[model samples]
Target: MLKKTLLAAGTAAALSFAGAAQADIIDLFTTDQNALILTDVGGPIFSQVSGANILGGFRDIGLQVFSDTGSPAARAIVEVSGGVFTFSNDNGIGGQATIQWDGGTDALDPGVLNTTGLGGVDLLAASADRFILDVLTADLGFPFQLRATDMLGGDFTISLTSAGPGTFEIPFAAFVGVDFSQIGSLSAVINTAGDTLALDLSVASIVTNQVPEPAVLSLLGLGLLGFGITSLRKTKTA
Candidate 1:
């Protein structure tokens, strides 16, 4: 019954907010340790910190597709739930992960932080996860591409299926800083166990800065509905 209500609410919200330019993910990364994190752009602001780690296992082989717009068939957005953009990504031979965002306001934080280090990370020399980030655009509605962000700007695409079936990356962490101009402070963690991986955020520790549009609209609609319904009832009784 609750699920039904939420679905109806979401649909109604989508309708009222038609032409409100929805947000989509810009990138998703799944490691050999089987860990995944989705980065998105141009939508509503959303963020969560981990009170615990979310775990899951996946296959060793999959797809790598891209879309030009919001379509996964044309380019890559986010979310790595087994047959999305990176369908064969489970054990892809060569692939890349690209991410960037800026909702109407700041949405989810791109930074993933760690106090107790995660395993299998290709880390930086500072004892923290030092990722090589390159800004590709200021446009928030287009598809972002992931490539070999090497010194030579070489074309060394990553293949998840590198060596042994269980072989994976190293131990390290990633800190994706969201734009400070909008909303700020989103820390995350990525871990791996065998063929699967996990994402842990510092949710219970930080302040939630953004609210999804659907929730806000629902509250407003309910207020209006109650006012109308009460007026009708009062007139009937009178």
Candidate 2:
């Protein structure tokens, strides 16, 4: 009964302000160690951080550790259940990890992706006007590629430099040939340049939405939804 009421109330609140553009934060992936599963691996062909590690409704995400260049044969110790996705490389194998976010439910698919609008929310449309990729901590000279796939299988790639304790604003105009309104998924391909490297990475989006305004709060009339208010701000600091 309580769950039904909360859901109904939330729907009302959303409909009440459907015409307005609100500021909100869309958490893509968080590596907070407080609640995580400790998985230790060495050169894993395919591995994933499931259960609580994956956010609700975005169940198809995947994490893969690999060597970009196969010659050196990179061996990595990966820790995905913590404040950072730690990738420790022993040799100069150019260690890297691929974060697959394109929503796919195929059980055989190694690269799992996220399902679009499963929660009745258009991630890109409901969030802020700008998209800022926030990487909390990482080794120096770390490089990554952020790929955005659309409904038609078209992709837009953005090369990212590791700016630990800071944020990078992805330019809106850079996503050429991509439909912003109908985005399918987003993948982060992270890499380490050093021979022996210890890289810690956490990815998220810092968006601007206007849900905490007094007018909206007063209309919602539910304190249980206070958690949403707290999510408006970034929990991690640089």
**Which one is best on lDDT?**
2
Q: Write the per-residue lDDT of candidate 2 for residues 9-46, one digit (tens) a residue.
A: 01111223322455443343453322221122333233
lDDT value for model 2: 0.41
Question: How far in Å is the alpha carbon of 153 misplaced in model 1?
Answer: 26
lDDT of 1 by residue, 1-238 (tens): 0010101101111112212222211122222223232222222222321211121111111112221122232221223333222211222111223222211122133222211122211212222211211111111111111112111111221112111111011111111221112211112111111121111111011111222256744654553332211010001110
* TM-score for all models, in order of appearance: 0.19, 0.53
lDDT, residue 27, model 1: 23
Off by over 4 Å in 1: 1-51, 54-73, 80-95, 98-164, 169-238
- Candidate models: Cα lDDT each: 0.20, 0.41
